[model samples]
Target chain A: MKYRFNTSTMSEWKIAVLFLGYVLATILAPTTAAENILNEESARSASEQQKLGAYLTRAGNCMGCHTAQGGQPFAGGRRLSTSFGIFVTPNITPDKEAGIGSWSEEDFWQALHQGKSRDGRLLYPAFPYTEYTKVTRQDANAIFAYLQSLPAVSQINPPSDIRFPYNFRPLLSIWRALYFKQGIYTPDQSKSAEWNRGAYLVQGLGHCNACHTNRNLLGASEEDTLTGGRIMGVNWYAPSLISRLEVSSGDWTIEEITELLATGISKRAVASGPMATIIRQSLQHLSIEDIRAMAVYLKSIAENNNDDTSGTLVPVISENMKEQFAQGRKLYDTYCQECHGVSGEGVAGIYPPLAGNRSVIMASPLNTIRTVLNGGFPATTAANPRPYGMPPFQQILRDGEIALVVSFIRNAWGNSGSWVTALEVDRSKSGER
Target chain B: MMHFILLITFLLITPVANAAKSVPDTIAERVKACTICHDNEDKIERHAYYPRIAGKPQDYLFNQLRHFRDGRRHYQPMAILLENMSDKYMLEIAGYFSTLPLSFPPPEQVSIQPDEIKLAKQLIHSGYPARDIPACSACHGDTLMGIAPSIPGLLGLSRAYITAQFGSWRNGGSMRGQVSTCMSEIAKKLTDDEVNAVTKWLAAQPVSTQPGSISVLSPALTNRCSNIVLGEHTK
Candidate 1:
């Protein structure tokens, strides 16, 4: 080394420090950047999951059943009347002492998928866990996260007033063995994604079959899930979904079905009774795509292909029966003709048409009889806020008169359906399915 | 020849009797049918929301029937009933109800406070000049018994019915004819409180024993009502 300042050495030392700093940055920069990126990704996913959970909650109408009338939303105190007894829905809000606040994601998944509580206790079918059992774990977890985000409502769950034997929670395990199938919705590879999604919603979260399916004495749904059934305790008949002679018959276009679902009113029909409630609380809030998917799934179900010989078996009016038809005709003119129209072509968008109407000429006259007796009021929704209501003839018309008028509406104009007897009318009046 | 004449006479008399029996039966049946919903003797008010159509002015009844038929009124039942009926038939039906000697029941006790009653009375009698609200009694006779040939009496109607009618009018529920309805124009000016007040006051009024005579004075109508013109029927 020369005594004079060596510029090259100084430059070399400076280069060495710069190289060390670069190496350090290469090691440390990624750790910090990756951490930030991972954090951002997780936060984004959490929000997305929450948004989906909110949508799913709305689709299932959780607030409608969970929350009591005029009570805090999701602070479940609503009394749901059932054959088993009254079920006071549980608080699903995130309250540590009162609600599902302490429930982990796995615990939430178990409740929804296995129909069991966090403590491994069997849950009641009244919670519609039979339907919720088909919900995906991801969806269940998302719902849990969304619920946890809500302000913790410290409302205590009220005990159910269930009758004996059914009240035993242990017995529910046996019931679950018989009725409940624990599994996430398996997408059918052969079907479109939309169709599968619709199927999942209709058969699972929507639990349409809960009301629409016929239940045996054991409360298990019949093999044909959506072929129609009488709602237990509720006097309404959920019409057959797959029959050619009922509502949602092959005659309906997909648009019509979606329209009915979204707006609660279509050119063909209006949603009334329990169906109206479904439309108002759940279906209307869904996206058009979801509704169309549901419509597609519903329409794909085969129409009742059994060659209906009943169409050929039109009842010949006897002299005595002629008097009944005349009376029915007079009654229709006096009470019904003003709204239903002269030729049974109801005012478009206001009154449902009777001529060639599926509800009018359905294979089972039960729904028509119920509608006439109870009066069909279309659900009030955003689309049709002030719906026209059909006045109930229960007070005004006798059982015989109701039967006669029902028979007349069924057979009037282009409509052709089996005659409803006075005894049938009486049975319906007495709340028999 | 005498036997032939007797046979012809018998045929003529038989046909006449049958026609007489059937025509009256049809019209009478129709009229009697209305009483099912319109007339309930037990209740203080005849019906809950259904107005007592009996004893209304012939022209007023006819106009309402026309309005229902023509899509001016929002009632489905009335519209459907009148949809296919001829104007002549509507006129006959309106004439029949008008001539029926029906007595109005006394007003039911309203549930509003004294101040509310005073406000209602002011609106009905004096009206709020600041808001250009003509007194309800201005067109409806001085007693609110309504003028003949057009104006419907506000008395004897239930509070609900009055309130509903006002609401409907304000919301374009009565959108018939080439001209805007006078009721529609009048109803739009009313605040919610004014509507409640007027309906309460109007519904509480007792029906005068005598039917309101047609007003002779031609007061300048604030609004042009196509359906309200005397003797001028739309369709």
Candidate 2:
């Protein structure tokens, strides 16, 4: 620049330097400001994302099955009893050696979406990845971030005590091939947003089908997810959600379903057994909107025509049957009339009504017989802190006597359900016990 | 026309008489109605929350019935059942239950920790002077078998029932009474831990061989409980 004293050359060089400086400043200044903004935005969103993830985790009730009694939360050692064998839950904490700490977001996503580990190892269905597979990658990443934020607990999970053929990890791949489908939920265009959200939660994070859907011998859920099934090895029936004659029947209002899920008690039913646990741990914590969404979805499930009782012939009460009814009536008067009411119209807020109660009159009389014989207490929850209980008649009533009482409840007070035979009662009682 | 009228009257009167006859008359038969929730007389400990009323003091039982009827207590079923009953009939029922022989099964084997037992023993015998909580034995008698006519024995009741009663008292369930109940006053002074310990220990205790009401009052009760009355006939 000093050598070129000529006016034109000097002006050109000055212009070139000015342009270069302008380019450098223009490129550097906004990037630095943008970096600061990006940092602040990310920091803010990260926490919000974590909060959402925490909510989702609660909705999924991950800690319920993962955390063992007296063990660190999420540092799993709980033994889940199944018909196949006892499966020990693994540590989900962020420990590098014992948990998923070493895993990348992709690895975690693979675990949930494909039921596979970072090393391409197949995961057991007990992890509930089949349902988790419907989870979006963004949501999976958020969950991973939340898990990573937790304190790393180095708890080595006990090895599962599964039987030989089932314990083989390679077999899980074959099982996945048959049963597992890797896909995110595609919202139905025709349904409302609430319904779609409910479907997503029910089919994915809530994993209602894990207990509610009937499973085949191979442990794959049968075609219909809402049709209901027996809980394996537990001898408790998770009644059909779709059937008009079963749980959440056609007569139930959406509000009743919401109330039952939120408070563990409703006009029509109370949450007992496993359902109580689900309400306490999972459903009660959800937002009212989410609960309403679930109710909407549950209500929209079409009533199965097969459940219609119109085609079936009501049995004629023979003289012997009349005698049995009389005997059952006497037993009811002596034991049940005070709380259940003379007409089976139970006292509001104190006792559940037996008159036209779906639980009492469902096609499967397993729960009723078991409830009468063993007596079940309603699940104590925040909403229903002082729930009324039914005392066990196992010690007081014989099998035949239990059968009579159960049959009486089923057939009494304008209810028209199939008769519960003594043999059925005996079988259910023994099986449950 | 007169004969037809007489026949119609007879038909109506006969059905009414039959209905009256079907109603439980004897105290034993009437008490059988209670076994729907309460256990049978012989096996009174079978139900968890239902108290054994078979051998409770006559005055105590009468007062409870009165309280239920008068809305001083709040059990819907009890209130409804006792609503129309005459005071004399309730007293008769109470008298019948009181005279019946008291029988209790062996104390239930509840798994209470040593620390809990220690806390229970402290509260039961010494009382919490710092919190102004009097010893349970002060009013319940040194044997905890209860004093004459009105005080109820704590030994034969279930832990759940005892706890619930204490909880009710603490929650102002006895506020309906014109005078503060002794239970309400005592329950208010106790911490939740103390309540739990006391109930658990009391439920696990073996009822004394002489489980019947005593003639004398507990010596520690310098002040009489206004809510309790020995009823002229019971005395």
Candidate 3:
């Protein structure tokens, strides 16, 4: 009880001991998969099997992918398009024909690891064998067990529509040879158990890089380009997740982040659009450990310092804008000045101002015009638990009136969005984009 | 083990039992038209976004409708078609949706690039060691099964949606209250390749990524309110 230890000395001793233990373990650790497992007949219990199913759910992101564009949750057929091509997801029900009902656990493993079908034919790489190949056969088998336990439903599989060379299935095998490596998720024994857990989910199940990482012309992701991935046909740009590379949030705690991912609702931001579905269907069902793992891993990226919040497009006071200012000012004063302040700050959580919003002056202005005419909404997050949306003015406002409203907001206050015509709104509504 | 099962069973049934209390004695006047598209047993196939609503948490579903009403989440069809809706009616709709049992359909197997998978996995498993990208599983879960009431499941999400979201965060998209915007911060730290790699890996993973319910820590992860992109809703 009277022992006293110096902080520096204690730290030095701990470091030395850790290094010694690492060196010792490195030489004594088993060399291969064969050396790891002593038995093959072990079966997961009902409880274990259920937990295993939960594990597989996180690993596969089942609800996020399998759910159709507007179809049943986890029922496949959401069309995904990339520079390479488009692929429609398949169903996972136990149906003998339409679903994976006929496949064995071995077949499931093959498809995941080797990208090969139950009959031995190569499966398309879109199935994510690249990452899944890292999962252990034991884990894969557990997922299979969970699948077998579900009720079977018959839903016909859909064919893909990727263009030309992208349509070639055999070519994926060639690609696999270069990238796919079959094995269990290996934990870096040198790292902490927490770090290892993070690795398991990110690499094995969460698959965060698939969206955050940038790809080359051949659709290969470049290492340095992580968190800077290419944007698809939509005007959407995937942000970087490497905090060392950039910072995207003004402030976010580890716990706040986990809660956001779990419920799609947090004090900072609410999940919206496609992400809403992902949260409601996919991440929300994840276990507390997995949520923590995701949070821990994301928090580890705190070094990134890129904040493009007020990047550009803040409406400048220009000669032309000055010229149109009078007309626009009169319009605003007559129609909008009553509820909206002359400064256009807008009511909190009720009316959003155009001052510093990128979405307002975005290159594509559909959301703006549409919002003006149709009056859409924001999603529910903890910050603004109950939001008040704007009502559509299509019935009350004429086309020119809508145009004037849009143009004013686009250029008003600090807003820098370009002028928009009623015709542009009409074009967008007609599906030109 | 029995206790766990019993607890879950009770959790599942308690909400429905409470829902039954709200029904009016006059069955005809208190119509259940909402059940047509919101039933737990039926398969909603017309549109994939229309999630099967049965068996969901009543509070969660109600929050969504209120979100739609508040204009945080858009639902043109709902407002234009169901405008004049009362707060009570919206809550009623949410109650009906919370009764559906989750049913997963078969998955479609697609192909992908090997090199893409390679880079994606590298980032996913360990993150960019050179840059400090944390693994995705830290918060989402190793199994990715979400906890109850508030947390969402990560299994079976569409890669396109996932990628799009990360893109939104990168490009500075706003979500509810701006609290959950941490993902945007996390995404901002990633390189383009990391996004693509993670998205591709997620899309390609085996179906039903997780097996059963994953525990959740909603209160722990979603309490902050800094980064307010929009102070108020715009008219």
Ranking by lDDT: 2, 1, 3
Superposition-based RMSD of candidate 3 using all C-alpha atoms, in angstroms = 24.4
User: How far off is residue B140 in model 2, in Å?
Assistant: 17
| Comparison by TM-score, 1 against 3, better one | 1
TM-score of 1: 0.62
Q: Which of 2 and 3 is ahead in DockQ?
A: 2
Per-residue lDDT of model 2, residues A1-433, tens digit only = 1111367877798678657765675688856755665587679879988887878888888887788643688999978877779889988899999988898999999989998889998988888888998877777878888888889999998888998788888988789888988898888889877888888888888888888878888888764367878887566788888877777545667787888888877756776656766776678888888888888888888474555563375778899988988888999998888667799876544467899787788888988887776564455456765455566675567788888888898888888778778898777754322
Report how far residue A31 has shifted in candidate 3, in Å. Answer: 39
What docking class should model 3 receive? incorrect
Candidate 3, A212-317: lDDT as tens digits: 5665566655432245453443323345555332223324677776776775554334443344434544576676666776677666654445554543545456
What does candidate 1's lDDT look like per residue over A1-433, in tens digits? 0112467989899778657765675688957755665587679879988888988887888877788643678989878776788889989999999888998999988888887889999888777778888787767778888888888899997788998878877887778778777776777889887888788888778888788878777677754368888887667788889877677546678888889999888866877766776786788888888888889889888474657654677677789877877888998998888767788876556667899888788777877887777664465566765455566566467888899999889888868888889899877754421
Q: Candidate 3 lDDT (Cα, whole model)? A: 0.56
Better of 2 and 3 by lDDT: 2
Candidate 2 achieves a global lDDT of 0.74
